[model samples]
Target: MEIIQTCDEMAMACRVAARPLGLVPTMGALHAGHLSLTTQARCDNAILAVSIFVNPTQFGASEDFSSYPRSMERDLALLEEQGADLVFAPPPEEVYPAGFDTWIEPGAVAEGQEGEVRPGHFRGVATVVAKLFTIVRPDRAYFGQKDGQQVAVIRRMARDLNLGVDVVTMPTVREPDGLALSSRNAYLKPHERQAAPVIYRALCAAEQLWRSGEQDAGALRSAALAVLRSELLVESVDYVRVVDAETMVGVDAIGEQAAMVAVAARVGGVRLIDNVVLV
Candidate 1:
C-alpha cells in the first residue's frame, strides 16, 4: 500500500488510482471496527483508501490529544492486509498548516449531545472531514454507526456542500461483551475495561423499552440513564436521549421515522459513547 502523508501527494494518488474509489477516514489506532469499513469498501470499490490522522482540532483543552494512541507501523500493516491502495497519514503541520483558520461550522445536526458536551467538536470534525473529502475526492466514504451523530453531521455537511460523495455508514462493530470499539478504549484500565460494557447495556435497556412499545422519549432516556447510574463504576452521564437519527433533534414520541437511543458516559475516567436505533 502506498503511504502518503502530504495532501498533495494523496490527492495525486487518488486521481491516478482506479475510479469508483472509497475512503475510510480514521484517527489511527486501527481496530476491527475500522477494518470492517475497509473490508466493505474493498468489496464495493476498486480503489480503497484509509486516512489515519488524529486531528488536533477535534480535542478540547483537557482532552487526551497529546496522549492519544498512535500505532503507525501497525496501522499500515493492517491497512496493507486490508488491501488499501493508499493510506494518508498526514502530520499535524501538514493537515493544519501555518495560518490555517478555515473551519466548517455544522448545522443543527451537530447542536446537542456531543456538540454541547465537547464544544466545537463537530466544527473540527466537519472541517477536517471536508478537507479529507476534498483531498481524497473518493466516490464514496465509509463510516461506522458507532459515531451516529458524527455520521449525521458529515452527511449533512456533504449534502449541503455538494461534495458528490456517498457517505456509507456500516454497522457498529462491538466486542463479544457488547462494548463498542473505539480508539480511546485503549486508555481504560483493567477494572475500567470491565465496567465499559455497561455503556452498551444501557443503550440496550432503552432499546428494549422502545421494542416493548414504550414511545415516550423521556422514559426511554430515563431507562437508559438509570442503567448507567446503577453502575457504580460510571462516574457521570453525559446524555441518554432519543433523537432523530439525521436531525439529531430529540423527539417526544417514536414516529415512523428512524429514532436513535444514544448514550455517553464517563466510566472509570474513559468517556465512552454508544447507541442503538429504535425505529
Candidate 2:
C-alpha cells in the first residue's frame, strides 16, 4: 500500500489512480471493526483508499485528544494485509494548518444526545470528513453503524452540501460477548473492559422490548435505562433514547420506521456508545 501523507500528494495520487474509488476514513489504531470496512471497500471498488488521521479538531477541550490511540506502524501493517491500495495518513499541521479557520455547521441531526454532551464535536467531525471527501474524492465512503448519530450527520452533510460521495455504512463489528470494538477500548481497565458489554446488552434490552410489542418510545427508553442502571460498573448514563435512525430525532412510537435504541454511558470512566436498529 502506498502511504501518502500530504493533501497535495493525496490529490495527485487520486488523479492517476483507477476509477470508482472507495474510501474508508478512520482515526487509526486499526481494530477488527476498521478492517471490516477496509475489506468490504476493497471488494466493492476498483481502488481502495484508507485515511488514518486522528483529527484533533474533533476532540473538545477536556476530551482525550492528546491521548487518543495511535499505532501507525501496526495500522500500516494491517491495512497492507487487508489489501488497501492507498492510505492517507496526514499530520495535524497538514490537515488544519496554521490559519485554518473554516468549519462546517452540522445542523439538527447533531443537536441532541451525543451532540448535547460533546458540543462542537460533530462540527469537527463534519469539517474533517468534508476535507477527506474533497481530498480523496471517492465514489463511495464507508462508516460503521456503531456511530449512528455520526452516520446521520455525515449523510446529511454530504446531501445538503452536494459532496457527491455515496456514504455507505456497514453493520458494527462486535466481540463474541457483544462489546462493540473501539480504539477507546484501550483506555478501559481489565474490569472496565469486562463491564463494557453492558452497553450492548442495554441496547438489546430495548430491542427485546421493541420485539415484544412495546411501541411506546418512553417505555423503550426505560427498558434500556433499566438494564444500564442495573450495572453497578456504569458510572453515568448520558442519554438513552428511541430515535429516528435517519434524522436522529426522537420518536414516539415504532410505527413503520426504523428506530435506533442508542446509549452513551461512562462505564468505569470509559465513555462508550452502542446501538441496535429496531426495524
Candidate 3:
C-alpha cells in the first residue's frame, strides 16, 4: 500500500489513481469498527484511501489528546491486509500550519449530546473532514454508525456545503459480549472491560421496550437510565435519550419516524457511549 504523508503528495496520488475513489478517515489504533468502513470502501471503489491523523482540534483541553493512542506501524499493516490502496498519515504541521485560522461551524445538529459535552468538537470534526474531502476529492467517504451524531453532523455539513461526495455509513461493530468497539476501550481495566458491556445492554433494554410498543420518549430514556444506574461500576450517566435519527433532536414519541436510543456514561472513570436505532 502507498503511504502518503504530505498534502501535496496525497493530492498527487489521488490524481494518479483510478476513478470513484473511496475515503475512510480515522485516528490510528485500528480496530474492527474501522476495518468495517475500509471493507465497504474496498468493495465499492476502484481506489480506497484511509487517513490516520488524530486531529488535535477535536479534542478538548482536558481530553486525552497527548495520550490518544498512536500505532502507525500496526495501523498500516492492518490497512494493507484490509485491501486499502493508500494511507494518508499526515503530521500535525502538515494538516494545520502556524497561520491556520479557518474552521467549519456545524449548526444545531451539533449543539447537544457529544457536542454539548465536548464543546467545539463537531466544528473541529467538520473542519478537518472538510479539509480531507478537499484533499482526497474522493467520490465517497465512509463513516461508522457507531458515531451516529457525528455521522449526522458530517452529512449535514456535506449537504450544506455542497461537498459533492457521498457520505456512506455502516452499522456499528461490537464485541462478542456487545460492548461497542472503540479506541478508548484500551483504557478499560480487566474489571472495567467486563463492566463496559453494560452500556450496550442498557441500550438494548430500551430498544426492546421500544419494540414492545413503548412510544413515550421519556419512558424509553428512563428505562435505559435504570439499567445503566443499576450497574455498580457505572460512575455517572451523561444522558439516555430517544432522539430523531435525522435531526439528532429529542422526540417526544417514536411515532412512524426513525429514532434512536443513545447512552453516554462513565464506567470505571472512562467514558463510553453506545446507541441502538429504532426503525
Candidate 4:
C-alpha cells in the first residue's frame, strides 16, 4: 500500500489512479467498524484510498482529542490487509497550516443532536471532510451510519455544494454483545465496558415499541431514556431522540417514512452513542 503524508502527494497519487476511486476517511485507531468501510470501498471501486488523520478541529475544548488513540503502524497494517491502495495520513500542519481561517459552515442539519452538544463539532467535521474530498477527488466516499447525524450532515453538504462525490453510508457495526464499536471504547473501564451495552439495549427497546405500533415519538424517547436511567453506571443521558432519518429533526409520530431512534449517554466517564432505524 502507498502511504501518503502530504496533500500534494495524495492528490498526485489519486490523479494517476484508475477511474471510479473510492475514499474512506478516518481518524487513526482502526476498528472493525472502520475496516467495514474499506471492505465496501474495495468492492465498489477500481482504486481505494483511506485517510487517517485525527482531526483536531472536530474536538471540543474538554473533549478527548489529546487522549484519542493513534496507532499509525497498526492502522496501516489493517488497511493493507483490507486491500486499500493508498493511505493519506497527513499531519495536522499539512491539513490546517499555520493560519487556517476557512471553515465549512454546514447550517441546519448540523444544528441539533450532536451539534447542539458538541458545538462547532460538525464545522470541524465538515471542513476536514470537504478538504479530504477535494484532496482525494474520489468518485465515491464511504462513511458509517454509526454517526447517523454526521452522515446526514455530509450528505447535505455534498448536495448543497455540488461536491460530486457519491456519499455511501454503511450500517453501524457492533460488538458481539451489541455495544457499538468506537475508538473511545478503548477508554472504557472494565465495569463501564460491561454497562456500555445498555445503550444498544435501550435503542432496541425503542425499536420494539415502533414495531409494536407505538407511534408517539415522545413515548419512544421516554422508553429509551427509562432504560438508560435505570442503569446504575450511566452518568447521564444526553439525548434519546426519535428523529426523521433524512432531516435529523425530531418527529411527533412515526409515518410511512423511516425514523431513527438515537441515544447518547455517559457510561462511566466514557460517552457512547448508538441508534437503530425503524421503517
What TM-score against the true fold does each predicted structure earn? Answer: 0.99, 0.99, 0.99, 0.99
lDDT of model 2 at residue 187? 97
Clashes of each: 0, 0, 0, 0
Off by over 4 Å in 4: none
State the weakest 10-residue window (summed lDDT) of model 4.
204-213
- Given candidate 2, what's the lDDT at residue 61? 93
Model 3 segments more than 4 A misplaced:
none
Q: Each candidate's lDDT (Cα)?
A: 0.93, 0.94, 0.93, 0.93
Candidate 1: tens digits of C-alpha lDDT, residues 29-114: 99999999999999999999999999999999999999999999999999999999999998999999999998999988999999
The C-alpha RMSD in Å for every predicted model, in order, reads 0.8, 0.7, 0.7, 0.7
For residue 271, give model 3's deviation from the true position in Å.
0.8
lDDT of 1: 0.93
